[model samples]
Target: MKTYRIRKPKIVVIGGGTGLPVILKGLRSESADITAIVTVADDGGSSGTLRSSVNIAPPGDLRNVLVALSDMPQLYEDLFQYRFREEDEFLANHSVGNLIIAALSEMKGSTYDAIRLLSTFMHVEGNIYPASEEPLTLHALFEDGMTVSGESKIAKTRKKINHVYVTNTNNTDKPKAARKVIKAIEEADMIVLGPGSLYTSILPNLMVQEIGEAVSKTEAEVVYICNIMTQKGETEHFSDANHIQVLHQHLKTKFIDTVLVNTEKVPENYMDTKTYDEYLVQVIHDFKGLRDEGCRVISADFLELRNGGVFHDGEKVVEELFRLVFGAKY
Candidate 1:
């Protein structure tokens, strides 16, 4: 007999790239209404290249989120994820997911509608939307007065992001927030952020003014899932406190109430190696720093990676978050 559970609270996860998908996978089991707000500023690889040549929002992050929410039917998901390998060929290195999204966007007359249609086909459990409808180019103005254009270049340069703003500021067709998304935030038991690249994945959505504001006003207790490792160029030497500080700086609100940090220690052998050790992030000891920022920190053993590499155990992370929200560990 099938036992029906009470509908879980809505969850709005804002970010782009690989990290958002992982969180989606874990939370899907909880049956919360999920809404993913993806960054559209990519201009590298398949997504960026397509955005530049085709003049549409990059579909890479949106593709990843769609797949994560998709029911795994073995070949079904595999077929969607497969990328061509041969260089110089027409479809070289482009994800099948990206191609599918791009084609749907063209046919439907808008990227937003296309994703909605694709979600139906994939049978994704939750909703996913790009942060904006009009394509947004990520432009970074460094403190030294030099400006870096494009998400890829800005990500690689070893500079503190002085300021990030979108191009085509005149375009007013901001993607309507999924009605479910705003409702989810308002009704959510909790909201989770990060465990991904700060500037690339986390901050890009916050850079969108409306999205940032929505986060500020939501009644849900906002929980930041801090990244375990620092990106050398982007978040160099950033402690958990610094990460929260950056988000607070950008939003100018008391949005983040609690931070979930990984306190698990990686094996010494794993840390001493070069390639595997490259971006290893350590836990922040500056509890006082976090306290100053008006957020309480919860440290736990939340590290694990299914596809390999260091990542917060999404299922476990969600478990912790759910416990915090409901006031009892599940």
Candidate 2:
């Protein structure tokens, strides 16, 4: 593990889904003050069910993040992650952590407060914040000008996405970041985006008005860990630069300062498509396009193929992140 002499670099990681936890888990071993701003726009599976019933921000992402950063024993983490068998009608498919989060949200009267309380109990080393105080409905406008609402349904449409925005689920009001979310972005030495879904997981968090504004103005080095694979419903033929382009288009600013791109190739017929169907192909690299967008590209063989799935080697990514952080500081 690498340590900082003066002060630990503050890293604010923004995005949701399975990818956020991967990055957080790696960051746990490094000497860094980490804060994760996870998307709450999910309306699928257990998260969606809880959001509809309890009216709290989706807890699935938050739960995963908590587990990722927790210093608790493996058994405790396993217990929190345990999901009920589908045979149990009332508790079917609900993770224990999600249920706990729901109960806490009800007891505390807000999801944000519930998470803060849970952080203490879970022994999470860093901050884990829901992107918004209220549940948000993600709306995507496709290239064909068709607008689709709900994160769960957007990809199902298989339409080309033009842009996406969020709205407070309960009213017409704009969705606001949970307290301190913007402050984390402002104070961060570096802001890391993605290794997750472009439209659903990553963009939804940035779509929060204040969060987007803060990112646009923050002096921190904004780094995008471009996805290893183009998503089926989202970025079917997208190059690495296309991913960056979408982010810039959504925020209406060229805020990203650096991009991490994977150069290693996935061996032919290595991925099990049946298990990981959302991914289409390796994200085509467009170095010129990335340079055109004014981003400093860091290309490497940061690949981790596990159980026939392609993922970012978290430790490798963290090594590069530390180099960037210390390089910028010194």
Candidate 3:
């Protein structure tokens, strides 16, 4: 039988944390080529414990991304995400997937290889690349001359963040992306930046030397997904424009070609603070500032409240991303 091959649009999605998986799940439903470049600077919770013990690239975010794009059964995915709550001392609250990634990383000699192997085993629909092959440490410089050495500690300070950068954990050297990550950006039709923490999750990937430079110089249309609400410690009282401005300042260039902002009003006292305590307030709008920086702002009712938390509607955001990708060709 003569078979026809499909040509999927090359889409490069960046960032990590809880946000990347939401969008990835949306994109998984579409017939498109996706390459998720994830942040490896995570230093909290289960990821932190693993990183501190075995020196693997914190696998929590990557694990979530892997499951998000996997076509496996729900049982398998759940098992991978399942955390140990038993009386096991070393494995308390650690995920099965994280341990698997750590094991593969040690066996394969790098995180890149481990992820590639897992992707194939999971029958993942898209590519997942770590921002760098080696484990990275995130360092943030605050506006008041305070510097935080880890991603976990940066937000706790609740101080004004000036800029953030990453270095390979074993040596004092500038971190660089794998060649695959660079090629993915160079060839992508569209590059999506956010829906994650500004300072901790998103910028860490861009701060890598080659990856940031590629993002700045790539001809692809770069899009930023504005968060629905301000984070307590990282982005307290930040406006939509403030988020984009911070990215511009860090990259030292106006790389974002477009921004997706939520316009729907968050009802007062609608969110249960006890359930979702990380959120502070709705992000204020600054349309003038967004336009001044040459961003094509597309605002809509992108807000969706579920599980007592406010989030960007992945379906709506993906629809806008498709529109921008189609426009970029013309």
TM-score of each: 0.90, 0.98, 0.96
lDDT for each residue of candidate 1 in 114-220, tens digit (9 for 90 to 100): 99999999899888888777677677777788888777888677777776766543264553443345665666667778767777777777776666777888777
What local lDDT does model 3 show for residue 40? 93
lDDT of 1 at 130: 83
- Candidate 3 off by > 4 Å: 1-6
In terms of TM-score, the best-performing candidate is 2
RMSD of 3: 2.5
How many angstroms is residue 198 displaced in model 2 relative to the true structure, after the best TM-score fit? 0.7
Query: Mind giving the per-residue lDDT tens digits that candidate 2 earns over 24-82?
Result: 88999989999999999999999999999999999999999999999999999999999
A best-first ranking of the candidates according to their TM-score comes to 2, 3, 1
Best by lDDT: 2
Residue 233 displacement (Å), model 2: 0.8
Better of 2 and 3 by TM-score: 2
Candidate 2 Cα errors over 4 Å, as ranges:
1-4
Q: Is candidate 1 or candidate 2 better by TM-score?
A: 2
For model 3 the TM-score comes to 0.96
